[model samples]
Target: MTDEMNNAQEWQARAESAEAALSRVQAEVDARLIRAELKAEALRAGMVDLDGLKLLDTEDLRLTEAGDVADAPALLARLKRAKPWLFGVAMSSSSAANPPRPEPPRTRHANDLSHEEWLAARAVLLRRR
Candidate 1:
């Protein structure tokens, strides 16, 4: 009976140890996944350095997790407000994916005048004649 009790206690201890180890692994995995998500968001917002992006506070973490982050500009602005040091350097943003087509150059000649202007000028010339 005594041996059986000791064996049961040992089994219980091992089980508790395993449970603790599993919980730790789970926490680590969750933390990594959160970092990955934030990194992805940062990259989408044109942030170059994944290392530079750190979840600021519990509210920030919750906001990211809840998918309540703002658009790219607002997100960048919020991050700048939170971590001004991170934005201290001049980070280069990519040019718009497709820049608007350049307007075609005007084809009108330098002396080109509107119809009204031309008519008025002709009237003045006739008066001079």
Candidate 2:
């Protein structure tokens, strides 16, 4: 009876430890998933810096059954409104609203010169000196 009791207690302790470890792993995984979701949402919203995520209050955020942040878009929108400096200018879907600027023709520079061109220029410069 004594041996049986000791064996049962030992098994219980092992089971408890296993449960604790499993909970820790689950918490870590959930944290990682939440971070990933927030990052994706932030990128989509044109967040200039990822560090802006640290400013967010995650206490109110809930996780969906799919393991995604439920109020992620809303949370990001609030953050963007609160701290507009953290995000870049929002891109418009229609190019008609803002047309692309035309670029002027690029002038040739010393860096653009080939070996032969460089030698000729060097010769001309040396003669002028």
Candidate 3:
């Protein structure tokens, strides 16, 4: 009877140890998740525009290889002072507005042309406008 009680006590101690280890692991995971959530919230709050295309620093203005004005805020401020129309385009394409969608292909009548002809027609259509 004493031996059985000792074995049961040993098992209970092992179970408690495992539970404590699991709790420690869970706490670490929870902390990491909380940090990640906070970072995401900070980014969202600090976001000046949607695509993150505009930088927080405005003084660094230059044209990128992709032709986008690099120092967007300064460029925007300049445009606001100079050309409102150009500024509007920049603002519309920035994170503050939904991105411009590519224009859909113009459809041609299937009955008027064969498949190969339609493909060739589409290529010509795409090039023309």
Candidate 4:
């Protein structure tokens, strides 16, 4: 009930509020640091987009950091299992830089075998396999 005791209680409340704010700010800073670290790791592993890792959840990021994942490729493999949208339809590196080789057209030979011979040859191939 004393004035000094009342002031002491108010100060204690103020200290707790400050501590909570500090903890919140620290958490935000730590999150930013983690995102930056993940981006660096992705770049080192030759990933094209570091921001993709930034889109991952905290738990996913924590698991990546804790798991036996070796590089961004491995991390991406796991993330793809959960978020297939991260990667659009897969494409072989046959982009315009290295145009895709046109597949050779299949054709019957000039000295073609009859159906019976072809059947026998197919059976032989299957057995060989």
**Which candidate has the highest TM-score of all?**
2
Tens digit of lDDT per residue, candidate 2, span 61-128?
76799888998998999999999999998676875766668998888799999999999999999999
RMSD of each: 16.8, 6.7, 15.7, 12.2
Off-target runs (Cα >4 Å) in candidate 2 are: 92-129
**What is the per-residue lDDT of model 1 for residues 46-77, given as tens digits with 9 covering 90 to 100?**
56555666444423343345544434346556
Give one digit per residue, the lDDT tens place, for model 4 in 66-109. Answer: 43333545666676676666555657676667666999987876
Descending-TM-score candidate ranking = 2, 1, 4, 3
- Residue pair clashes in candidate 4: none
Per-model TM-score on C-alpha atoms: 0.49, 0.70, 0.36, 0.49
Which predicted model would earn the best lDDT?
Answer: 2
lDDT of 1: 0.65
Model 4, runs deviating above 4 Å: 59-77, 80-129
Q: Using lDDT as the measure, what is the rank order of every candidate, best first?
A: 2, 4, 1, 3
**Local distance difference test scores for all models:** 0.65, 0.91, 0.55, 0.67
